[model samples]
Target: MSDIYDLITKRMDLLTREKEVFADNILRSSVPGEREKVIKFKNLVTHGGATPKAQATGLKSTNKNHLSLSTHLGSTRMTTKKTDSDVSLSGNTINAEDQLRKINDATTKYYEMTSLYQSYMRRHNTVITGR
Candidate 1:
């Protein structure tokens, strides 16, 4: 169903954005007065939430060993906000421990979502090919 695929794609997009934000936050943890970036999904609902269709003009990998490049689907749904927790001694709002934990969580969610997508495709293939 298109709706199911759209939902899964949106969720994966959100997770990807979360992971990126968390990674960035960890990198800025040591910088003085650097506020951590966070992902806010509430506004995404109002912001055209549709996934942009992929362009047909991109380069394609013609060989098994060819390097594959990733494309960003659209603008991120991330928003910056001050952390409510205590800032570090260096005036950085990012806590490395928290960022690491968030990154792990996002990674796990992404993996699960991908697995589900794969399972769906496998079933679809089986039905279509009768193999």
Candidate 2:
């Protein structure tokens, strides 16, 4: 079991380093690198994973996209709402909450992402160090 953990940890360590590099590339506004990082991180997270997310099911997606209730202007028809994504972490897909979260106190998403990252690092470290 420890040997398996060790092997996993080696791969995870490499993934972590890759993640850091990808993060730096994203920070520097490198789109291709950011995309590559997303793919690499996804592979690392899902490597030998047991369960599949709901969206990953073989059938068609059952989830429905929530439509915007936003009002329209004169001729402009304010349907196209765009906002700056400066507040969101690098590589996150943009959405309504991304903007509102930036405009308002959107702590849950940030907190959740932080907690997840911390947990990932903690587990990875524990597996590697065995302490």
Root-mean-square deviation (CA) per prediction: 6.4, 17.1
In angstroms, the error of model 1 at 17 is: 1.3
Q: lDDT (0-100) at residue 68 of candidate 1?
A: 38
Instruction: Please name the candidate that would achieve the greatest lDDT relative to the true structure.
Output: 1
Model 1, which residues run further than 4 Å from truth? 50-77
User: Which pairs of residues clash in candidate 1, taking residues 3 or more apart in a chain or in different chains?
Assistant: none
C-alpha lDDT (0 to 100) for residue 74 of candidate 1: 47
- Predicted candidate 2 versus true structure: per-residue lDDT over 12-120, tens digit per residue: 4444443444344335443421222223334335433312332244323234453222201101111212344442465533333333334233244444545656677
**TM-score winner:** 1
Name the Cα RMSD for model 1. 6.4
Residue by residue across 27-92, what tens digits does model 1's lDDT show? 888999888787555545443443333223344446857543323334345556766578778877
Cα lDDT listed for each candidate: 0.72, 0.38
- Per-residue lDDT for 6 in model 1? 69
